[model samples]
Target: MSDKSDERKRAARDRLEQQRELDRARERRRRTLIVATAVVGVLALAAVVGLIAANAGKDDHDSQAGPVATPSGATGKDGLTLQVGADDAPSTLTVWEDFRCPVCAQFEDAFRDTIAELADSGQIKVDYHLATIIDGNLGGSGSLRAANAAACAQDAGEFAAYHDVLYRNQPAESDDSFADNSRLIELAGSVDGLDTPAFRNCVEDGTYDSWVEKSNTAFGEGGFQGTPTALLNGESIFPKKGDEEISVAHLKKWVAEANKGRKPATAGATPSP
Candidate 1:
């Protein structure tokens, strides 16, 4: 009887021990899982932060921008469009751009010299229309202010110089640094005689704000897709999606080839009204 009792107690104690072992194993698994999950979350967060940091400074460098000014001596009509190249050129290149646009800056980088060459040589006439679609798209006033400031430069007859300067110093599309009017004035310093008091007051006063609005309206109504849109001889070269890929050399070749067979427009041909 005593042996039987002893055996019963031992069995109970053994079962309890087994249960405790099971509990301990489960606890270990829980802790390990928690640690692993925490580590994965930390890694994921770190990766996201790194990505954002890397791309924030997209195109614009920290240095003040400088533009290679190309003068076609075309037109500065309505304080909006600045025309360059010879009026009698057979090919007409019309461009719509914004100061805060990175892609437009890319186009400027690749084609500025080429455009200058064609316009200067009277191979093509280039018309530049400043648009503030970026301001509308990005929810900032930089586009408007920058366009106005460019217009201010027009009065000084340094539109080409300041235009180049603005693109040179254009901030990233996400950065609204161009919205600060002071920076606009500071950028004016890049152009000779463009940083004067009149230019300063003009930028501060937002003198051409109305014209910027008008230009934006024209851009919206012009049936265009996006910034850096270019039209050659009143034909769309930048169709929305699925259009042929475009590059600097492609553009230059397009112009050169087009000029070969282009018929010169009659004098007084619908002056950019």
Candidate 2:
């Protein structure tokens, strides 16, 4: 009987020891899991912080990227207007255009000769305002790049010719070919005395990029609906003036009536568009 009692006590002691060992193992695993979770949380927080810092650096670089270099002889508000006719002409024709806008290209194609005749005859002065709405609407920099290149052409005293050239070689609405500086320089070769080192450097360096940005911003603030916004004497007259559809004859008649008794500008000769 004594031996059996001793054996039972030993068995109970072994069972209790085994349970204590299992409890210790569970505590160790819980501690390890908590440490692992804390480590993962710390790593995740560090990654987020690193990403924020990187973005902040990029923002700083972008803010100080380019200088606001306005083209020479730019007139009107903020020196954004590129005038293309006699300064003292009787009527003022304000034109807002985008390089990538097909409608603007169509308008130019339809009225280029008439508008040039009017401008050259000192009947009206054309105020050209460049915009980059297409670049904004589409996900590309073609409009901005082409506008800058045109501004560079303006600096070289070939704005009218270069402007016509750009329209003549304008790409499709979805095509961003104008973003290539080489292509812009290549186009400049067609203009007389326009494909110089200065012009190339200007296009390559994006000298007028900030000016283009400013012009785009102004376009947004002007409450204008879209590109090819034409105003004669501060009144909208694009597709139609009042009741009459705009035509070549109508344009001449309107200018004639506007300048009824007034004499045409006798100032210096303006470039033919």
Candidate 3:
């Protein structure tokens, strides 16, 4: 009987020792799993941070692209303005536009004829300022490319015609079709005498890319809200002027009022109004 009792105690002790070994093994596995998960979490965080830094660096590089090549006949501060009428006109119509902005296209469609007539009559001068806000917001280079192409057209002395053509053939805001130099060149065919080798070279080479970037930076620094920001004689007059909603008649009336006593721009006068 004593031998049997000792044997039973030994068997119980063996079972307890085996259970402790299993518990230790489970604890070791749990600790390893926790360490592996932490390592993976850190790696993922590092990857995200690296991606952000890389994108920010890319943006900085793009904003400061090589030397600026100002377009021919460009005027105003830093040669950023693309004037579309006699500079001596009594009233100056300042238009800040983005090629990829649908609202700007709409505004152009609505007021293109009236604005053209007013500009032609020497009653108002149009100062066009290009911006690339859409490209920054929508993750594409269409705005920059199109603006550069337009600057090329300005170099070719077909800025007015090409400007109208771009709006007429403007693609959907989401479509980055204008980013293609070939597409911009194809559009240039609509403007007579504007699709020459020199113009094509300018578009392909992005001669004014830095200039466009500078203009975009200025737009951001100007405290302006959005595209199609139209101002008349330094007063905001788009969609509404004071309490009156902007219309074709209202636009004409406003120009007439501004030019009440002022003489129309005489031929051969100094270009600066």
Name the regions of candidate 3 deviating beyond 4 angstroms: 1-67, 268-273
Candidate 3: residue pairs that collide:
none
Clash count in backbone of candidate 3: 0
How does candidate 3 score on lDDT?
0.90
- Compute the lDDT of residue 221 as modeled in candidate 2: 96
Write the residue-wise lDDT of candidate 3 on 93-129 in tens digits: 9999999899999999999999988888888889899
lDDT to native, each model: 0.77, 0.91, 0.90
Clashing pairs in 1: 72-85
Q: For candidate 1, lDDT tens digit of each residue in 1-273?
A: 999999999999999999999999999999999999999999999999988877665444433333322222325544456766557888888999988889999888877887777776667777888888888888989998898888788777787778888888888899989899999998888888889998899889887777777777888888888898988877766632236556667777777778787754444222331
Error of 2 at 23 (Å): 40
For residue 141, model 3's alpha carbon misses the true position, in angstroms, by 0.6
Question: Per-residue alpha-carbon lDDT of model 2 for 20-86, expressed as tens digits?
Answer: 9999999999999999999999999999999999999999998987557888878888889998888
Ten contiguous residues minimizing lDDT sum, candidate 2: 264-273
Better of 1 and 3 by TM-score: 3
TM-score of each: 0.64, 0.75, 0.74
Q: Which stretches of candidate 1 lie over 4 Å from their true place?
A: 1-79, 239-244, 261-273
